[model samples]
Target: MDDVSSDKHPDRGGTRRILLAGPRSFCAGVERAIEIVERALQAHGAPVYVRKQIVHNISVVEDLAARGAVFVEELDEVPDGATVVFSAHGVSPAVREEAARRGLDVLDGTCPLVSKVHAKARRFADRGDTVVFVGHAGHEEVEGTLGEAPESMVLVETAEDVRRLTPEDAERVSYLTQTTLAVDETTEVLGALRERFPLLHEPPSEDICYATTNRQLALDAVVAESDLVLVVGSANSSNSVRLVELSQRQGTPAKLIDRAAEIRTEWLEGVRTVGLTAGASAPPALVDEVVAALGELGPVEVEERRITDETMHFELPSALRGTAGSRTSGGQS
Candidate 1:
């Protein structure tokens, strides 16, 4: 991570001010998910099989892998009766059934918020309403949610998709969304849905998780004042990518980098104030490394712009609750 060289940006010698977004990285759900793996390792020993990446961050996955958590794409990879932890993104009912058939000791890491959305899908579909799901296609979270009521649900990625929808009964339609999404764009899609289906039943509350919402709201406070914005997260992270897009939508040049070494010298040219933020799944240590590397290039002044304080906390799964090293914290776990 110490690949940042001062010689690369010699011409840009000055005090670089970095505005850090508060409530940026490691949300409560992510914390809970990670702790589940760690405690499982302690309770059940090494080689604890995990169904997915757990969360979207590569660093978190790699760290857990080093500590004996084996991540697999499917249940077949695990030996029968071995311990398996589900990723934070809820699994479909079919996946649950498969795990049960394998007789695996399952430890569910699904975020409470995502579980709520899944329950809504079942309820809406049972009521004979066609559920319109709003989220990106091919995403694991979307796939899991859609599976809850596949026959009774349809997915729409944009306002145009909503326009093209021709349900069996247009009047008997309800809508749900993936937990991670761009808030503004979702609103636009919802507006189009309302125009097309005046009686479209909406979710009881916003589907977008509080951590994702807080990170975006915090970034909004600093993006306009920044010459460039850098979001720290892996490419596959939907919430992290959305942060970069949010800055770009506001006419500011933004880039997504997993670490400080990925920062380009050209981005620093004539740039003074830089806005720094991390996705909900990213580790805070990565953010610290970025700031330290930036300081090595020249003087750095870091100011944290806090829009709101996030005190949300999720409890660990019951299977690992009483295990050693299972303590929780108010901050990132």
Candidate 2:
């Protein structure tokens, strides 16, 4: 199941307790990206080549691989004219052009929010503005967005990094951010950029996706009451990593795990309440497995704390909409 519930079941009894974040796991953008791959598989058949991990979650990639989705590092590895998917992190215009040149059938799984950041960077370059893109260096999304206007854009990962920057045009400056960044940390970096360039122009709208903000906010509350926090997600997942950092910033102990087996027994020592949440790309099954593992240690009670309601949904790529009916197996549905 894509969604998870923290509600305590009547059949279960335990002194240990689990507090689940309501808005945790499988956000709309991740949902849409996963759906794109599944629908493409249904419409085009197996052996669909994905240029990268469809999303950051290993479970998702492994699951898709089990269903005949071949993961590749580059376009040349894919047979010419075969179908390929771009990851949800988005890609550079160069990569898109290259795919066209290769005569490959391409399905972009880039999140719409990420596409918006790319568009904003292009616009800033067109206006002759030096764009300061605040994000981790070498991340897929950062690489993609930077590729949009590399000559006009400078990448900064921290407040100090921003201070070291010497853009060609300080007076004509604009800023954009990666969508999956930790909200509070990104805000602080943005604050520093503002201090440096008081005339800094902001993106057309908030670049951080609503799901990232909501999950961080919900995790804030989860941290307050938890003896220890465990974020269920792959280490490579950006949003999942942020949730762990957000908890640590709150002075709470937190660990990032891909599954239940990674949960250390020593961490559970003297802990009565554990807060559990998964990244946007993480599946609810991982959360369930963690809860079951906790129960094995002792009696357990499950409780859900929903900070905000997320009713947001992204539309499928127009090319796959006709095959939407066959998309019954994976994604958030």
TM-scores, each model vs. reference: 0.94, 0.93
lDDT of 2 by residue, 112-152 (tens): 88998899999999999999998888789999999999899
- Backbone clash pairs for candidate 1 read none
Given candidate 2, what's the lDDT at residue 213? 89
List model 1 lDDT by residue over 1-333, tens digit each: 111233422333467888998878888898888998889998889999999899998888888898899999999999999999999988999999999998999999999999999999999999999999999999989999999999999999999999999999999999998888999989999999999999989988999999999999999999877878999999999999999999999988899998889998888887878899999989888898889889988898888999988888888877666888753322331
Question: Can you give the lDDT of residue 107 in candidate 2?
Answer: 94
User: What overall lDDT, based on C-alpha atoms, would model 1 receive against the true structure?
Assistant: 0.89
Kindly provide the TM-score of model 1 when superposed on the true structure, using C-alpha atoms: 0.94
Highest-scoring model, TM-score: 1
Question: lDDT per prediction?
Answer: 0.89, 0.86
